[model samples]
Target: MLNRLYFIFLLVPFLFLSCYDSNGDTEKSATLPIYQDTPYLQDYSVKYYFNSSVSPKKVFEDRNGVVQVLGKNGLYRTSAGQFLVDGTLIADNTYRPLKDKSLNGISLFQDQFVYVDDKAVLSNAWAGNLFLPHDLENANLLEPGSNFDFLISDGKELQFLSKDKAPWKGTVEDGNIIQIRYGHEANVFWILGKNSVSTFDASNNQIKTIKINNEATSFDVVGAKLYIGTQNGYFTVDSELNGKPSDLINKLPVPSITWIESIDEEIWFGSDEGAYRMDIDGDFNYYYGKRWLPGNKVVHISSGHEGRVHILTDNGLAQIHFDPMTLADKAAFYEKQVRDRHIRLGFNASLVDLKNGDVNSGRLDDSDNDGLWTSMYLASQVYRYKVTGNEEALKNCYESMEAMERLFTINDVPGFPSRSFERSGYIESLHDSDRWQHTDDPEWDWKSTTSSDEAIGHIFVYSVMAELLENDLRERAITLIDTLMGHIVKNDYYLVDFDGKPTTWGKWNPEYVNARPIMVGDRKINSSNIIAMLQTAYHFTQKEVYKEKAFDLMNNHGYFENLMRPMSEIGKAPEDADDWSKMLSEGWNHSDDEMYFLGYWGLYRYALNDTLKTKFKESIIDHWESERPEKDGAWNLLTAVCETQNFDLDEAAWYLREHPMDMRSWDVKNSHRKDLTFIEPNFRDQTTEEVLPPDERQVQRHNANMFRLDRTGGDGSEEYSAGDIWLLPYWLGRYLGVISEPRLNKE
Candidate 1:
C-alpha cells in the first residue's frame, strides 16, 4: 500500500500545481566587471565500450571521420556522430577496405591509404608493391617518412621502404626498438628503443644510437626535437641529435610515461596510471580514473578527427570532446540530469548501483540528508526562476517545496520533519533501519533522527522562497517558517522527534550551545544557525516573540560572542574538555562549513537592523578569509551575498570552469602527483599547499573536504547529482549578478 502511495505521488501533474507571478521579482545586480571575463570552451567525454573478446591496442581516425580500433587479433570501426555522444563499439569485422586479409600495418601517406603486409608495402596512389624486401610480420610502429617513404619497426629493426629503392635496415646498438618516427625538420628518421634513442641519416645511410643513463620507456619526435620518457620522468633532446640526453624533468602530475604521441602539433603522454596533455601554458591537464577513461592503464593516446582525443585503455576507449559552453548552458544540462534520473519523490537523489556508469542500470537511493540536498536543489531552481523568470524553473521550485511540506505532514508530530520516507516493508534494505518507524498510515515508513543540518537547510530555502515568491507559494513558504520556528521556540530550541526527545545535533538552546568550548566549531555554528532561523521567521512572519527570543539568546546567553568568534581560533578542544566536545572539534568539520554558509543567507540578508547586518557581513568576510585556500565555489559565492568587493571571484570562476563534466564517484588519486606542494597536516585537513583542480580530485558535495587528494575503493556504482552540488552555486552566482548571461561564443 505504501508503494502504491509512492507511485501516486510520482504521477501527480506538475503544470496545474503552480504558476509564476510577474510582480514579485527580487532586486539584484546586472553585472560585475571583474566576473565578466570571456568564457572558454568546456571539455566533456563520451566513453565507448569494446567487446570482451577483443584486446584493443591502438585507436585511429580515418579521413572519412570513422574511428578505427586496431586490436591484436583484428580491426574494428565505429561511425560516431559529429558531436559528442556516447558511442557504440562495432565488433566482429576488421576494416579491410583494401581487401587484404593479411595486412600487418596501415598509415596515411599524402592523403592516401597505405597498407603493408608481410610480403609487400602498398598504397592507393601507387600500383603494386612499393618495396617488398623486408618482412613486416612483427611490425608494431609505423609512420610516413618526410620524402614519401614508410618507416616501420618490429621492436628489433627498422625497415625503410621507398618506391623503386632498396629497403634500408637499421637497429639500435644495445636495445630493442619501440618507436620509429620521421622528423620533418631534421630530415632524419628517429628511432626509440628500450633504453636508447637512435637516429637514421637516410641521406648517408649512417645510424647514430645514444644510450640513455635511465631506463627509457617512450619517446615522441616533434619537428626537430625528440622528447624521451624514462621511468622517473621525461626530457627533450636537441635538434642536432647530440651526444647525451638532458636531465629527466620530473615536475609532472605523474611521471612514469608509457607512450607519447605528437598529434596536430600538440604532444600527449600516456602513463601506466593515466593520460595527460601538456598545454601551451606549460601546465598539465590530468585525466585519470573512470571519470576520464575506461581504465587508468592507458595503452595509447591519439588524435581523433577535428581535435577530439581518443584514449585507448585495456578496458576500452574514452573519447574526450571539447565544446564551447557557458555556465548557464551547463546549468541547463544539469537541470535535465536532475529532472530525468535524480529526482526521487521530488528530492534530489543520487543514481546508485550503476553498472559501468550506465544511468539505466541504477536506482534512486535514500540518504540521511534528503531534506538538506533537496533544499539546495530547490534553492537553485528558486534562484534560476528569479533570474530568468522561467516558468519551468518556478514549477520545479513548487514541486520541491511540496515535497518539503510532506516531510512535516508525513508524521503526526506537529512542526517536525522526517529525515526521509519510503514505501513500507523495505526496512531491512534501508539505511539506518533502526531509526525507521511506521507512520500513522500503514503503507508508509518515515526516518527519524533529523539533525540541525536539515533544519538550517529547510529554513534557508523557506526564507528565500518567502521573500522571492508571491501569493500561494509565498504563503506556503511563510507557513513552513512559522511552523518550524514555532516548534523550536515552544520546545526550548530543539527539534523534538516523534519519541518526544531532542535529536542529536538538533540542540540549539543556551545550555547546549554554551556547553562546548569557544574554540569548537559547533559553538559558533549552532549559535549562528538558530539566530538566523529566528531572524528569518521574524522577518517573514512579523512575529515579535521570535525577535525577542533571538535577542535574549544573544544578549543574555553570550550567543553573539560565540557566533562572532574568529575562525582562526577554531581548533582542537582543550585537554580538559569532555569527550564529546573533543570529538566535535577533531580537525575541522566541512559539514559545519556548509551549515554556516547556509545560515549566513538569512543571518546577513534578513538582519533585524542595519547595525546587525554590518556585523554579520564582517563576520562572514572573516570566515571567507579563512576559507580562501580551498577555492570552493559555493562558499565563495555564498560570501558574495554579503556584497564584498574581494571575495575571490576569479577563483570561484575557476572552480566552476575547472569542475569535471562527469559526476561519477570514481577512485581518484592525486597524492602521487609531484607538481603539488605538500603542507603539514593541520586542524583543517588541508593536506596540500594549494588545492588541486576540482576535476583532478574526488567529486564531492559542499560538505566534503575540498583538499582531500585521493579516494580509493570505488567501482563507479554511483553518479552524484549536480543539482545540489553544481547548480546551486551557478544559479546563485547568476542571481547575485556576478556571473553574466550565457556569453555564448565569447571565447
Candidate 2:
C-alpha cells in the first residue's frame, strides 16, 4: 500500500508535467552575442587638499607692512622675516610664535595697535605693551568677541568709539550697547544696539539717541549715510544724525553680521559664516568658505591699501584682491574650481543582436555589461564642458568618450551591420549549445535581462557619438540606429530574458504595457531619457522625426502631469489635474516621488510647447497668487518648478530674496531612516557591508536642493547652470523668448 501511494504521487506529477509541451520548443531563438574586438578603459586622476591648522585667519596690507591675525595667537607682522612677539623678534623658522591667549580682535591706527582679548580687555600700545593704556571701565565681555573692533578706550569711565566723547562723558543713559561704528569724518559717530541709536557731536558737546525696536548687529559709515546691519534685517539712515532720521531704506536680509568695513566705495560686511559686499545702490554679492575666505565663520573685515580686502575668521586669515572692472570675476573663478573637482561616469551607446531570432530577448553589445552605459553619462557631462568653452573640461570629456568607444566590437551583423560595441570585459556565454545559459555564473553578467536599460543608454550615446565623430564613423552611427530600430521592431519593443522570454522593465511599480517608441524598449517612458534622446537626435540630424517624437511623448503621455503634480497637488489649478489618488495611496512607499524628475520638468518647459503656451500664462498667475503655507517640501518644489518653468519671476524672486537657501548650517546632516526604511549591502563585493549614514543621506537630499538652486532658470536664481553647454541650450531656447520682469518684487 505504501509503494502504491508513492507511485501514484510520482505519476500525478508526471501527468501535470506532460500537460505542456515537453519539447520546450518555441518559434524564435536567442540572438547571438556581438562582442566588440577592442575594449578600453580611460585613465584620469584628480588631486585635492584641505587647509592646515596654522592657516592664516585674516590678511591685511598697510604701507608699513602686511598684517595677519593668527586666531588664538596675537597679530603677526609679515613684512619682516622673524616673528614679532611682544617687542622682541622670535626665531625665523617658528611657525606659531605668538602667546597662547586668544586675540579676539585687532585694529591698526597709523603705527599704534589696539586689540581685545578673550576676556574683553581692551588694550592699546605703540610697540607691544610699551605705552599701554588700560584705565577704561573694564566690564565682562561677551564670548564671541572675535567680531569686535576697538572703537576707543579714553582711559576713563566711558569710551567714545562710535559716539562723540564730549557729550557722553558726563551723561548717563540706560540703553544697551549693541554695536558701534565710527563715522568717515572725525567727531561724528553712530552707536546702536537693541532698540536705539545714539549720535553725539564732540565739538558741539551735543548728544541725541533715537529709540528703535529692531536688533542691530553692526554698523558702518559710507559717506553721510549710516548703514546699520541688524539681526532683523539691514537698514540705511540718512546723513543727519540729529532729529528723527528720514529716508530709511531696508531691503537686504540680515545675516549674522560680525564686522562691517568700507573697501573703496563697496560696503563689505563680515558675518558669522562668511563675507559679503554691497554696492552703494544696495546690490549684495557674497563670498564664503572656499570662495573668497579661507573659512565660513568670518570674525572681522578691514580694508588695506590698493584694492585689497583683509578678512579674519575662526579658522585663518584670507586676502582677496578685487578689480572694479568685472565685479563677478571672483564668483566665476570659484565656479571653475568646483566644476574641475567632480567628474561623471556612464555609457553612451550599444548594439542590439537579432540573428538568432528572439528580438526582445536579444543581447546588448551581445552581453549584459553595464559599464558602457555608465561611461556614456559621465562622458555626456564632459562633452558639455568641452562645448562650453572650458578647454580643459573638453579635453577630459573627449578622452573619456574616445576611451568608451574603444570597448566595442567593430564588425557587421544581420540587424546591426556596422561596427557594434559592448560594455568592456563582459562575456555572454561559456557553453556553445547553451549560450544563453551560464555554466559558471559568469563574471559581470552582461547578457542578463537587467541590462536592457543599459542597451537604451547605448542608443542614446550613439546619437551623441554621431555628432562627435566624423566621416565613416558618423555613417556607421546611422547604420547602428537603423539596426537598433529593426531589432526593437522585431522584438515588439520589449527586452527579453536569457530564457528567450520578454522581461518586465522598470523597478517596483511600473507603467506602460508596451514600451513606447520614444523610449525605445524601456519599461516606461521617462522624461529624462526621452529628452536626452530627443535633444541628441535633434542636434545631430535636425530631423523632424526626432522633434515629432519629443512633441508626441510630451503631450500624449502624462509627462506634464508628472512634472506639475507636486505643485498642483498642493491645491495651486488646471495644471494640477487633481491626480493625488495614486500618490496618496502609495504614501510613505513613495520615498522617491520627490526625487524630482528634473530631466522631465526641466526639459518640458525647456522644450517650450506652443500648444500649452497659453496655459502656462494662467498657470503662472495661479501659482503666484496662491499662498504657500509650508516652508519645507512644497515650497522647495514650487521654487524649483517656478525656476525651471520661468513661470512667475516675481514669486520665485520673492522666495529667493526672502529665503535664500541658508548656508549657515550647510555642513549639517539629517537622518535618512525617517524616509528610507531599508539599507542594502554592497553587491560588487560580498565582503563589504554598505549602510547609509544619517549625514551622508541627508547630504544627498541637500545636494539635490542645492542643485535646484544652482540650476533653476531665471535671472533672480543663481546662473550656475547657464554655462552648462549640455543643459543650457535647451533652457535658453525655451524661456529666453518669454520676456518677464527680472526682479521678483516691485519696490
Candidate 3:
C-alpha cells in the first residue's frame, strides 16, 4: 500500500512538470535575449576643477563651446556661455544653466550635467530637476564629509553619485530614489577626501571605502584606475569599488604630492619638491627634479590631443617631447662616442718623449717637455680600451707608439742608431741638457744632466712597454735591455761620468762624489735603481733572477728599510720647524728624506714578497679611520701604494674613497719659474718662458695642491706632471674590471 501511494505521488508530479511544451516533446532549448549596452561619447572642450580657501570646490567645463560651472554660488548657465564671478566674466558661444546658486561639485554626462552643492541637481537645456536635500555638504558620498560629481550613461539609464551622508545615490523606475545607481550598465564614480577614498558603482548601486592612513594630499583617475597621493608616497586602485590598492611605483621621496593627472595612460604626479611620470603599468622612467626642472615644485599637468603633455610648475611651464625610440638611440650613441674619444685622446704619445728622436731636445725643451713614464703609462691604458671593442682609438695609440720608438737609443754609445741597430743590446736615458741649459748662464749647463733617479724610472717604463708590444718590437726591446745591463755592469753599480771616471756626480751633478748612487742620509744602499732594473726584468721575462733581486733590495738594505723608520727619527729642523717637517714627511725633501721614492718602493714590494702587501693593507685601513694631518699622510701614502701594487677591486675602491682626487686644486708655484722642474722621473728641464710657454704655464698658486696616485709634484710645482692623469686610467681600468687579468704561469 505504501509503495502504490509513493508511485502515484511521483507520477503525478512528473506528468504536471512534463506538460510545459504543447508538442509533447522534451524541450530542445530555452531562448533568452542578449543584452547589449549602448556606448555614449561625451564631447567636452575643456574640463577642470578648482579648489580655493575662500570658496567651495568647483567643477567647470566648456561643452560644445559653451562654458558652464557648478560652484558654491549655485548651478549656473548662460545662453551666450558667459558667467560672471568676483568681477571676472568668462564668456563663450552657447551656454545653458545647469544649476543655480545651490550646486558645487559638477560633471558632464552626455548632453547633461549632474551636480550637488546646496542641493542634489541634474540638468540639461531641455529640463532640470533637484532631489534630496538642498544642503548635502555633509553627505557620505564615499567617506564622511566628502562628495563627488555623479557619473551617468544613457544605456544604463542611471547615474552613480557619491555623497557625504548617503555614500551613494541612484534612481528607481518607480520614481523612487535610492542612494545608488539602479541600472546594470552604470558608470563608476569616486569620492576623494583629505585622508580617505570611497568608490561608488552605478551597476550594483554599491559603495566601497578605503582609508589612507597617510593624508590624501592629491588624487587623479585614468580609465578604470584611480591614483591617490598621500603624505608618504602614492597608491593606486584597480577599479572603482573592487580589488586591493597598489603603490604608485617608484614615487620619489618628497614631502607631499600637490597635484596629479593622467596623460596618454601615463601618470604625472607633482609634489612640493619636483615632478615624476610613470606609465599605466607603473613603470617609472622619467623624472624632472631641481637638476632638470627650473622649479623645485610642480603645480599642475594638462594633457592635449596626440600624446602631448604640458606641465606647470612653480618656476613656470614646460613642454616635453617623449618618444621612446629616439631617447634610447641617443643614449646609446652618447655612450659609444665618449668611450672612443677618451681612448684616442689618452694615447697620443707625441705629447711626451719615449722615442729615439730629438723631439724634446730642441723646440720641445723650451716648452715643458711632457714626461716619459706618464706617456707610456697612458699608451698602455689606451691600448687596454682599444682591445675591448673600441677600435676607433687604435690608430691614435699606434701612431703615438711609432713616434716614441724613434726618441731613444738601444745603446749608451752617443749618436742615433740606424734601423740595423735593432739587434743592439740595452737602452740608455738620453740626457739632453743643451736644450734646457741657460745660454746666458754657464753655471746651469752642468746642472741640467740626467739624474740616476730619472734613469731608474725610465728603465721600468721601457720594460712595461716592451711587455705590451708586438714580437718584432719585443725583440728590439730585448736588445735594448741587454745593452743597458752591460752599461750598468761596466760602471760598477754607478752611472759613468761624461769623462769616463767614477766621479761623484756623472751627468746630474759633477761636483759631489758618491751622490750619483746615494740614499737618504745615514741610510745604506739606496737600491731604487737596482729595484727598478729587477722589476723591469721580472715584468718582461717573468724570470726568477729578477724576482730574487727585488726581494734582496726590499729585505734589509733597500729603499724600503731605509724609509721605514718613524717620522721623528729622521731629518733636521728648519727655521720654520712645523712647515718644514710637514714638507719633509710629504716627500718634498728629495735629499735627506727618501719619501719621494715611496712609489718605487711600493712597486718593488708588490713585485716581490707578501710582507709588503700586508703592510699596505694595514696602512690604508688606519688612514681611512684616522683624523686630520695623519689622515692626509695616510691618504697620500696609500694612494701611491695602491697604484704600484695594482690592488684588486675591493682594495682600490676603499683607497679611492679615502683619498679623493681633487683635480681642481692643481696650481703652479712662483718659485718654480727660476729653477728646473722635473715633470716625471725621466723628464726634467729648466723653466724658461719657452719651456713652459707663457700661455700654457698658468700661475695659479693652487696647482701644486692637487695630488695624484702615482705622479709626485714637479720641482716648480705648476700643473700636473705628464704621468699624473695618464697613468691613472691604467690602474683605474684594472680596478674597474675594464681589462681582463693576464694569464700567468704558476711556479
Candidate 4:
C-alpha cells in the first residue's frame, strides 16, 4: 500500500508542471525590492573557570589597557592584555614579591602600582612594593579620576593622600558615622551618617548637610549626579549632595548594592541579588548563575580597555563582551540553526517537529497534524534547493515527499489522506472521538476524519514540488496530484472514508456549501477552495469535464460571485441570510485567511483563465491591505509571492532578525509593561494598541493573532518548534528573491 502510494505521489508533478508559460502574461513583471546587508545577532559566548587554589578578588585593566586579575593568592595578567577575548588567560602570578604578605586592594599610578596591605605600598618597573606609607592602617587605594590617591579613616578623622604629598586630615560632625565620600576632584567633601550627609569644603568649613532616611554603604560621582548605594537600594541626587535623591534600586535586580562602577553612562552594580548592568535608559540585564558566570555572588564589577566587563565574584573571575551584528546576518544564522537543531530525526528526512529545546524528541506519530507541519518544512527545502542548489535540501525534500504520500494508500478510501499513521499496537486513541483504524497491513494504523487543513497542505506541497523538483521527483509529484484530485472529483467533491460518508469538514459540494448562508466564511472559503481545486485538476489533466464542472459552479452556483466579493463585506452579511452560517460568522475568521492564502498558490499561479487570475489578484490585494497593520513576517512575506508596493521587504527582514533567540515557551506576561500603547479590543481580541516584540508576545502558530500579549498553548504548556514557522517565509522570500544570503560579518 505504501509503495504504490509513494509512486503516484512522486510522479504527479511531472505530468502537469511547467504548463504555464514563463514568458507569458501569467508571470507579470514588477519592480522587486533590493534589501541591504544586515548583520546577524550573535549568541552570548560564556565560558566559566573555577579553581579552589585561587580565589579571584578583582578583574580590571591597568592604565595601559592590559587586563590584570587579582586573586587571593597573587596577581596574573592575560596574554591578550589589550582585549579580553573568551579564552584569554596567562600563567598564574609568578612574581609575588611584596613588603607586606597581605595584598587586599590595588590602584595604578603613572607606570607604578600601589598596593594596600597594612599601609600603601607602591611598586614600579624592576621593583616590587618598594614604597610603604607609615602610620597607615586599613589603607585603600582609590581610582576616582586621573590621580591615584589613597584614603584611610578612623572613627573620628578622614585623611586623603595624593602623589608625593603628606596626608590631609578632615573632621566630620554628624549622626553616628556610617561611611565617607572623598573622590572625583570636587570642592566639597561629604560625610555619610545614618540620618544626614555632612558636607565640608577644602578649608574644613561645614556646608549645608542633606537629610536622608536610609543608611548609605557606598557613593560614586557620575557626570553631574551623585549615586549613593544605601541599605535600602541605590539613590541618585545632584552632585552637590544637598538635593533630594531618587531611589533606583527598583530598576536593579537586587535590593542592596555593595559596589558600583559607572562609566560611559553604563552602570555596573554588585548587589545582594547578582551582577547587573543598568544601561543609560535604566533597563537592566544581568549575569549571576553558574550557567552565565563563575559564581552567583558578585562582589565587584569594572570595565576595561575593550567592551569586556570584568566581574569579581566570591569564588572566581569572569569577563564578558558584546559585539552587535546586522539583522540580515542573523536571519541566515537562524535559518541554518532551525535546520540543524530542530529537524526531527529517524525518518532519515529533515522534518521539523515542535521541541522543548531539550533532549525530548517529538515523534512523527506524536500528533495527528504532524504531516501538515512537515509538509510546510518540505516545501521550504524545495525552494531552498532551487535557490541555493544545496544537495541536502533536495534530499530532504525527497524524503519528506515519501512520508507525505503514504497518508493516501495507508487509508481505505481511494484518495483520502489520514491525519497521521503509526505502527499498530504502539498507538492508543487520544480521545473517544479519535478516528484511528487499523490499516490493511496489520502492522500499521492510520488516523481518519481528516479535514480541509490537511488537504490544503497536501495540495500546496505537491504543487510546489512540481514547480521546484526535477528528474523522477517531478513526475511523482504530478502523478500524486492527479490521484488526489481524481479522488475528490470521483467522490462528488467530498472526502469519503471507510464508512462511505464525507468527513465532517471535507465537504465542498453545492449541497453542503449552499446550505450555509452567503454571510458565512465557510461559504466563501468553500467556494474559493473548490474553484481552485477544479482549476488545478483541469490544468494538470487537460480534462474538459473538470473545466465544465468549474464553470457550472461559477455560473450556476454563484461560486464566482462568492469569491469575487470584497473582504470588507465579510462581517456585514445581509439580514435575509441569517442562520447557522450567519451566527458562525458574526466575527471574522482569521483561519480563513490562511485557507485563502494557501489555496492562493493554486488559484493565482495555476489559474485556468485570465479573468479568474485578475479577480484572484484583486482578492489577495484587498485582504493584504486590511492585514498590513499586523506587521506579521509570515503574512507579509507570503504576500511578497505577488510582487507589488504592498510588500514590506525591510520590515520583513527586521521581524525575522529581531525575533528572540530564546525559543522556549515560557509563560510571558506583558500586561504589566508600562510602555505599551493600547487600542480598543477588536474581534478575537486581536486589536491591541501596540504590538509587542515577537519574543514578548504569546507563542503562537502563524495562524494565531500576532498582537496578542497573553497566549498559552492548547494544553496550557507546549513550547512549539520554530521549524515550520521560520522555514516557510524564509524559503518563500528566497524563492521570490526578496532576501539574499547575507555577507559573513567579522568582529
Off by over 4 Å in 1: 1-34, 37-39, 53-55, 79-104, 110-115, 123-133, 164-166, 263-266, 745-747
How many clashes show up in model 1?
0
Ranking by lDDT: 1, 4, 2, 3
lDDT-best of 1 and 4: 1
Best candidate according to TM-score: 1
Worst 10 residues of 4 by lDDT: 18-27
For candidate 4, lDDT tens digit of each residue in 411-462? 8688778777767786653422358888779998878878776677777778
When sorted by TM-score, best at the front, the candidate numbers are 1, 4, 2, 3
Model 2 TM:
0.49
For 1-747, candidate 2 gives per-residue lDDT tens digits of 222233235334423322211122111112211111111111110101123344333344444444544433345543221100001112212234235445544455443344544343333333343222323343212111122223332212234332112212432153456555555354554666456666655545465766655566667777766777764446666656554544334433235666777777888877765666777786665554332344566666776544446666665455553322110121132223223322222222222332211122323333233333333333333333323333443444454445344333222123321112333343333212222322232332222333334434445445544644444545655555445434433454334444555444322112342223221212122343444344344545566665665555556654444333323343111233234323222222111222122222323243445544434434433433332221222222323333444334333223222221111112322221112233333211111122222112111221123211111111111111112211222211112222111222322
How many pairs of residues collide in each model?
0, 36, 47, 21
Tens digit per residue, CA lDDT, model 1, 238-314: 75678567788988878888878886666788887888888767778888887887777787787766457888887
Each model's lDDT comes to: 0.80, 0.37, 0.36, 0.61
Error of model 3, residue 77, in angstroms? 33
lDDT of 3 by residue, 1-747 (tens): 122223235334432322111121111112211111111111101112222222323223333433343334443232221000001113222333432243444444443444444444444433553243433443222111113344432211234444433434342232211122212223444555555565555446665666555556667766666667765667777655467778544324353677777766677777765555666565343233311233445655645322334444454333333322211122122223223222222222122231211112211111112223333343333434333323333443454445334333322343211111111111122233232322233322222233343344345434534654454555655554444443554454445534455323222111221222222232322343455465555656566765665665466334455434333333333444445233323332322112223234334443455665555444433322321121122133324334333223333222222221111111222331112233442111122221321112221111122222112232221222222232332332332232222212211
- The TM-scores of all predictions, comma-separated, are 0.92, 0.49, 0.35, 0.68
Q: What C-alpha lDDT, on a 0 to 100 scale, does residue 195 get in candidate 2?
A: 62
Top model number, lDDT: 1
Clashes of 3: 47
Which regions of candidate 4 are displaced past 4 Å?
Answer: 1-30, 40-341, 344-357, 360-365, 429-433, 514-520, 564-590, 711-719, 744-747
RMSD of 4: 10.1
